[model samples]
Target chain A: MTAVATACPPAVRQGGGPVPVVSEGPALLAGIAQGPGLAAHLNRLGPAPRPSLGALVDMARDVDLRGRGGAGFPFATKLSAAARRRAVVVVNASEGEPGSHKDAALISCAPHVVLDGAAAVARALRTQEVHIVVSSEHPSLRRVVEKALRERVTAGECLDLRLHDAAPRFVAGQAQAVLQLLAGRENLPVTAWQPEAVSGHRGRPTLLSNAETFAQIGHLVRVGSAGYAAHGTAGEPGTTLVTLRGDGWAPEVREVAHGTPLADLLDEAETSRPLLLGGYHGTWLRPAQLRGMTVSRSAIAAAGATLGAGVMLPLAQGRCPLVRTAELVEYLAGQSARRCGPCLNGLPAMAEAVRALVHGEGSVRRVEELCGLVVRRGACAHPDGTARLVASMMQRFPAEVQAHSVGTCRRGREVSG
Target chain B: MSEHQLRVDWPACKGHGLCAELLPEVISLDEWGYPIVHEPVKGEVLAMARRAVKACPTLALRLTLPA
Candidate 1:
């Protein structure tokens, strides 16, 4: 109902912000491994065309643009909700998932694209302010973004860019958490729901998106919607940026066309081991199941998995996956904000159950019960996402679970507690 | 007559279980002893919801009967 928003003063405007890792599509990651300098970004993408607010929304809808922050929520819908009300752009670069590094990759390699999109949103909304939130842990990334902002200012672009360092924790990247951190409060999500578009950013409508979502917007502005739609399937336009890891190799960022075969991006012949899609909050699929799967939201959903913040880990064949999953659950449990009972209490209980099962100390039924108890119970999707990871691992690898229960891991693998 | 709604401030609710006892039709306790809102507290169930809200020791249960 209100289109007026006051910009909050920059808090430690040097380098800190939200932690959502980006799944920047190929377009966003254009000129791979290139310098994040303003001149390089300008040379690569050319000048971004200014579009009316209405035109921007239509562009997003035309290409079926979805947030690459992992939820895949249609970007157009969020744009429309905050269209006329107000705008303060918050970019999530936190990479909350421990395994994800795509957002940081973009910040390090292409900071301009993220800012270009963030500034465009502010310019469209007439707010003229944008905030890029990166993890406090990444000092070099902070320097990179700081350098990018300085370059933009030096180039005579009159945009207000504020950088704030935030706690480098999983939930710290949630939009609500970002807002809270910016407010200098404890970084925890509120229980009651006011859509950020309704009352975000100090109680004014704000456009909140991951760094990659803004990268997509930046590309959309550079190329009209059609040009942007040139890549990927008609259903899911644009390429996808995926962070590929596992097998003890250093994590790498790969950009591929939407719906590109999962087999293509990953070395399928690496091992016959099952792969985990969608990071820690994602599901595990057998190699056979992952064979024909594609990277688009619809295809990933069809494969009974999510491209969760674009992390794919194909485990090393010799590692006991059950033990690995147990460790992950324990980590997730510790990451809980601890405001909701189900998440706060249930996660540790679930972790205990999974740990027990791994050590031949308990039954899978307890794990299943804990999973059921936790879903749809927390204030945020953290608990539900955690449950999904646990439930899927149990369903996907019954043989592994069975072996763990019998105090043995798969043949040739030692069960480590 | 407009519908009534029930919500729990999860962080505030101490899993006292009184809400489940009073408003059994709309509330149930999970294994962790947390109250889960299972149904809408409208129609005849509104009265039960009100009792639960009043009896809530932590004063965390909220019943939003339309004004």
Candidate 2:
């Protein structure tokens, strides 16, 4: 296979990091991109004082702040549910999703803002305990968060904030897994009929959200729901942070209004090529499928894909999509938590089938069968996500699959590893 | 008559296949030997499904009222 070098757009680096771009809206990123320490955060966003629990819930409902984690559950519902009992707020900074860098970016640059959001939720719940769970794998992020916490303490914020280090597995970032880690258990998901919001983190109620979600909460409280809603579409209000990658361009974490066109971040010329929207667990959108599509969750869903975790990866040209998909499937197989038989056996089997397809030794029917068997059979969503991604690749690129089986590939070469 | 459904706590299940052997009417073992319930439990077979749930060595099987 031809390993053509992908061209990346030059990014303006601020304070040794990529500056967040806010195109066509007010900036929620405000002062965070310049690697601002706590002082700049205070100056820009000010201290996030806790509103009453009732008021916070009302505002969350009014603005409809969904969880920034891959699953877009309504934040208000989660908060109100957990608030019924003594609840702890958890800031899920353990970003293990491939192609997602917004969480770590927020932690490193504007950690206090994230802390402010967490503190707001804690106050609303009338709990001083707030846990910030970061992956132990990221020492730099740990240091940055610790430094931010110290700054918050020195500022006399009445928060019982604790920093926790969790194993960096993709499933480990799930709500149950994060809660388990916080309770000194292994970072693994457990099947439960009840939502974690009702009983979590040592069986007490818990309000957990992604770092970016908390940051948006801080932004929302600061700007109010109306001001936040002023920027994005009617359905999905407020700005969102998206990790825009692919097409040989340096992946950028951009803060754009919810309804910003996908074409704004990706080249319109390249939109015809299959774009891997969201991350690996996300879906592929065909060229015509993405035309006039906005980056909102509803808009992306309307295009037959999810805006999962707010990741946008447009496939670069001249690359074998099947080969890339096979490689990703292999990676995903390695990432399986192995908590369920279906995920353990099914993902690797599907990956192997894809590998065979990439080598022109397999048929599309085999892949489809594997996907049907794998989806919805795991303890977590990993297997289902992998199945969705693979299914989308097959659905969006049937011609490519047909060509691959005929001993020819779009790249016109054996792309097999 | 109250309708019931079979559920498996996948992590707790160890592919013992006892559930399938006992209640083959609804549960069958996949290629890997894990039990896959073909349909929800209903009618007089509910007692048989309960017996299989009790027979599961890992205690991963359960019958619950359909939501």
Q: Compare the candidates by TM-score and give the number of the best one.
A: 2
Show the lowest summed lDDT stretch of 10 residues, model 2 chain A: A1-10
Error of 1 at A374 (Å): 1.0
For every model shown, what is its TM-score relative to the native structure? Answer: 0.89, 0.91
lDDT of 2 by residue, B1-67 (tens): 8778888888888899999889989988777888777888888898899899899899998888865
lDDT (Cα, tens digit) per residue for candidate 1, span A1-417: 111111111112122333332233457766644456788777776777768788888888899888988888888899878765557778889767766777777777777888888877777777867888898766677887898899999988787788887687788888888888878898776564567876788888878888989988887888887888788888888877777782136456666778787767677564267888888888988777876778878777877888878888888656677777888899999999998888899999999998998888779899998998888776677888889989988998898788878788775565655
Model 2 regions lying over 4 Å from their true place = A1-25, A246-249, A414-417
Weakest lDDT window of 10 consecutive positions for candidate 1 chain A: A1-10
Candidate 1 docking band: medium
Model 2, position A107, has a per-residue lDDT of 73
**Model 2 CAPRI quality:** medium
* Cα deviation of A297, candidate 2, in Å: 1.5
